[model samples]
Target: MVLKTAIFFVISIAAFAVMFTTMAPLTGFLSYHDVPRIVKDNNEETNWFALTESLLWDIFLVLLFIVQHSMMATPTWRGLIYNLGLVVVERSFYIAATAWALQYIMQSWLVIPDYPLWIIDTSQSTPWWWFFTLIHVMAWIIIYGATFTMDLPELLGLKQCLYRDTAWEFALICTICLTARFTNKGIQ
Candidate 1:
């Protein structure tokens, strides 16, 4: 039992780290200057220190993931689908909530330069809105596919859906995406 717990914890951490390493840019952690400013002119250069910060942040995220994942065993396909639906709902909520918050921040702060907040301007061809929408749609599709094929454990009760391992992993990935939006630099 103890060993299972440890193994789960380690697996969760690894999962979180891998997710964060890729999703940071989608959240808004990077800026135009971090690479080449092709859109808004108020571009700021990338900070090298952010690399170190990202590493540390990933570490912390993984630790949290370990704790969360270790709480339950692997979920079956039905459970995974249920968890995926939950993720869709959760991501929808997050997208709406964060957009609202960004609007509030822009309104409240005077003399606010064109800086990347919760929203990031990736290119001149389209607004961040398009990119975010694309990402959300793609994520939903991937999650749905993963869930549809899962063969959930028979022991899992409907009421225990929230406690499934996949749900926690999905939630953690969303959180990591949120954090990465605010901290990532340009693609290295």
Candidate 2:
């Protein structure tokens, strides 16, 4: 029992660390990563094959994340882990998988040769550029604010195992998970 608890903490910490670190580049908050390297580059050179390959790779990475998030969140998947006598650390496993997916996407994401579908102004001189930057930052604020409405430790797979450390029992309460909302384009 103690071993399982210890394992849960390690996994939770590692997974959360990976996910947290991976998010910056994926969300365009970092300017030095692979995704940013493509967008900010001014060169318009197009190697058709390389661009196609890069795009396919990116699509695969996105699909990988989407599938992992969707499937692992299912009741069936949770029940499988629960029935295997692993119910206590179920959320940790899910978080670990999510971290792996996000890490893989962030690391292996190739720069599309003919990329940056839309021109982005990184300069701070223009009003429109600043407005767009504010909008992006606002999106991040809104997302984090919404997430903080939940039990953050539990949501991040920490509180569940940590509950055993103390006498306190952890329960899934005061949490809102935004999932499965779809519009015309695709799942968002």
The best candidate by lDDT is 2
With a 3 Å backbone cut-off (N, CA, C), the pairs that clash in candidate 2 are: none
Model 1 scores worst on lDDT over the 10 consecutive residues at 153-162
How many steric overlaps are in each model, in order? 12, 0
lDDT of 2: 0.70
Model 1 C-alpha lDDT per residue in residues 1-188, reported as the tens digit of each score: 45544443444444334443434443343222233433344466655465556556555555544544443323553366456544322322222333333334333333213333444544554656577667766765786467547742211122123234547567668878877877767333
Q: What's the TM-score of every candidate structure?
A: 0.27, 0.67
Off by over 4 Å in 2: 29-47, 113-115, 122-125, 164-188
